[model samples]
Target: MLTAPIERMLFGLSDDHVIVEPHSGQLMHPEALVAFQRLSADARDAGFDPQVVSGFRNFDRQRTIWNRKARGERPLLDSSGEPLDTGALSDREIVYAILRWSALPGGSRHHWGTDFDVVDRAAMSDNYQPQLTPQEVCDEGIFGPFHCWLDKRIAAGESYGLFRPYAEDRGGIAPERWHLSYAPAARELQDFLTAARLRDLVHKSDLALGETVCEDMDAIFERFVRVPERCYPQENT
Candidate 1:
């Protein structure tokens, strides 16, 4: 099933799924952008200026992020959300740790151009640093109102075809309250990207911790790649 077209589209190697848009200042799937704009307008009308901080990310971009985190060039956090000493962990452990927070190259939802990290730009100070932490979206935090508003509007979002991919803390990835996906397009890709396909790709890819990551393909796939539908946002709706 990992044919050339599948490989290209899944890895973000081709531009078939995305288009350049001035409003996003990045590439996005045309349908997704339209839905996002509607969501943005609705948020604005509700008194929040929501913006997409991250849109489409190709495999190479994700590789850079993975590699940096693996090599300790970037911060690696533990499951408890505390910083970890990557230098002390084995390469295999490093791989698992990275997967807790990031997808492997060619395995990220952002590759689909239908997933994005959104935030309320109006809520932050000009110099506010974005940590995307759980605290930041909690009831007392700065973006708390934004996430609360989103929670109420999520049901209404079905009309626009958008939903959160990580609305809850599933066993695999941490809960990313900011990550939204256009269900209409992303759901197809999700069904197509099975663990077997991901395992084959991981073995062949020059991923940062490829050897260790592939050594336990079944567990890795179950935990990171082959996420169940219950983990998606529609469950909340």
Candidate 2:
């Protein structure tokens, strides 16, 4: 429930442009970088050197990904188009897809440089199915080493002031088993990144579409982004 002090800035660069390069290992907050290094070392000790697959992105990058999914170029949804694909999606369809796999740039915890997405390097490929479930990946056992490492880190992270925002919240956003946040800054960034501000930025920027795009985006924000802030108290306390 901590409040981030800095104003949200747009950092949504394309997946290809992420500083992580071919591996998508982009910029991370110093603390998170340290934690990741520790996590990586631990994973290696456990017989796996998990690599970071994705990290900080800018709005432009997020938009690119969203657009690709909308065009059916990227498998943002499932085969039946159920949860992941969601059927003949328009740009509006891209909204949920973006939320499910990517964030709206500034809205993403990675943009603040405090979050990262870890994946097994050996299994990941250019032909990788973006919508594949973690369980599916784990079935290969390649992800096991990292999972075991995460179990230990999750227990010790709080002491280092790191926490998982998307942890144990399967009902809302898909649980990103690999996504971890540096809690001290992330708690505040969560509040600072609001649906209203994000919408305004998107509109003012090049990501803005036609009238339909605006309306659809408005709806998407209400449904997916405008949750109660950490400072909100039940019944106003």
Candidate 3:
């Protein structure tokens, strides 16, 4: 394994001007920063002026979200305030749901500060709800214009090095159609963020679990978490 010191992976926010929120962790990587700026600009051009609803998050924030979900303090879809029956779910199921709702902290691509959740800014003030569904954006009618703008900007010829890591295949993760990855450091960051490490972290955390949690965790890792990094290749060419 081409091991890099874990400490070397540590980085901080690039700018103080950007609005930082509880779950919106520090912004990292110049390419991603530019990509986001362009995304915001493109949204404005499309007459939406979408803002980043969520971004980089740490393990603590992730845990808080997960705990809230378990306590039925939030909704499964939007901010519905209905907690999920975590006791009925296996560890793997819980982890999978958690990933769909929030990343596993250290295992999150956002932790690298390269992935962001872009949302319609106007819709947020209405009720702090998501403006578009996953299907709505995937279709070429609702969020298609924004998608087209993002696609054009992230093409191989773009200087920003932004690429859609989860655009095509669902890959078991949530179909975050708006999420984008900055390739320059994304591959290394992905390698550093692995399923094994994430599982270990979950085991060490205060996650509530049912009787089948361990087995569910084993299955989840085998099925989704342990998949090889074929999509994210090494930083070559």
Q: Which candidate has the highest lDDT of all?
A: 1
What residue runs in model 1 are displaced by over 4 Å at the alpha carbon?
A: 156-159, 232-237
Candidates 1 and 2 compared: the better one by TM-score is 1
Ranking by lDDT: 1, 2, 3
- How far is 151's C-alpha from truth in model 3 (Å)? 2.6
Candidate 3, residue 161: the lDDT equals 58
- Comparing 1 and 2 by lDDT, which wins? 1
Please list the Cα RMSD from the true structure of every candidate, rounded to 1 decimal place.
2.3, 6.6, 5.8
Highest TM-score model number: 1
Model 2 TM-score, all chains together = 0.67
Against the true structure, candidate 3 reaches a TM-score of: 0.65
Give the per-residue lDDT of model 2 (tens digit) for 1-237. Answer: 212335433234333322332335366666666656766665666567566656665566666765565556666754223555446566655555556655554466666676666776655576865443566444355565556556665665422554455554433356666666666555555655555666566667555232344566666554454333442211210
Q: What are the clash counts of all predictions, listed in order? A: 0, 17, 1
lDDT of 1 by residue, 24-58 (tens): 58788888888888888888888998878788998
| 1 or 3, greater by TM-score | 1
Q: After superposition, how far is residue 193 of candidate 3 from its true place, in Å?
A: 2.8
* Error of model 3, residue 167, in angstroms: 1.5
Q: Rate residue 54 of model 3 by lDDT.
A: 57
